[model samples]
Target: MIHAQTLVDAHLYPNQEAVMADALRALLHDKPQLRIELAIHRYQTEDLSLAQAAHIAGVSFDRMKALLLARNIQLRLGPADADEARKEIAEMERIIARRELP
Candidate 1:
């Protein structure tokens, strides 16, 4: 079977990391629920903001919030300060620009 090394040797991808990234992109595209689960996991463990998680999961902010709530994950609420709030806004803007939300 063709593996990451095989693809790397063929120069189809620059490196194993690129191969893994493409593989993950395809897998997440084909399996959206996994993306949501991954986003939730990152959100909980990686200190990712809700908007960032939503972007990663390919879901809307509200939908992500609901998913977290359904799983009994306590929401983190608003940003701690102005800089964080700005970051959150930037993420939200990116989500909106991508039309990820309703």
Candidate 2:
């Protein structure tokens, strides 16, 4: 991969940060399909929220949902395991008991 410093030194960008940002932006611009695929992967892998993935792909929430549906990927927003649900419920119960005390 071409380094950001190389691009900066070549005068393609004013600074290292700008070069890196512009390179990434250009890559996404050039490969719109890749952006969508990456966003869906991030959402599916739980690396980003649906909204975040949509933003990253420069699309709307509905568009992101459509993409996911097209790929037959399930929408998972909450915990997948019973243990996590129990922990959440326990926290909620503690909060409720505290509120009832005062």
Candidate 3:
């Protein structure tokens, strides 16, 4: 369980307190789909990993992957570094060379 307090300045609204209370109630109880959609959006934007988003959505990794695919959301493992790509290429070349020799 996490405890959080948000300070909102709704002075312009006539019934600020009531509006805020209703909004909070809707967010907490009537909007589970909204939470899942936000989690998926975060994953799509690379703000969260698939695992993190899955945890947020209370789903498995495979389920998250399927959801992303269903939504046409591309899964980014992480940013690819040039050095890492070069190292991977070199390793593959070495493996291929050894196979050719045998």
lDDT of 3 at 21: 77
Give lDDT per model, in order. 0.90, 0.76, 0.67
The lDDT leader among the candidates is 1
lDDT of 2 at 57: 80
Tens-digit lDDT track for model 1 on 44-94?
998799878888898888999999999999999899999999988887787
Local error of candidate 2 at residue 97 (angstroms): 38
Q: lDDT of model 2 at residue 80?
A: 59
Query: What is candidate 2's lDDT per residue for 45-79, written digit by digit as tens?
Result: 76555656776687887898788888888875555
Tell me the deviation in Å of residue 30 in model 3.
4.6
Q: After superposition on all CA atoms, how large is the RMSD of candidate 2?
A: 10.5
Q: Clashes in candidate 1: how many?
A: 0
Better of 1 and 3 by lDDT: 1
Between candidates 1 and 2, name the one with more favorable TM-score: 1
For candidate 3, the per-residue lDDT at 29 reads 59
Off by over 4 Å in 2: 1-6, 10-18, 77-102
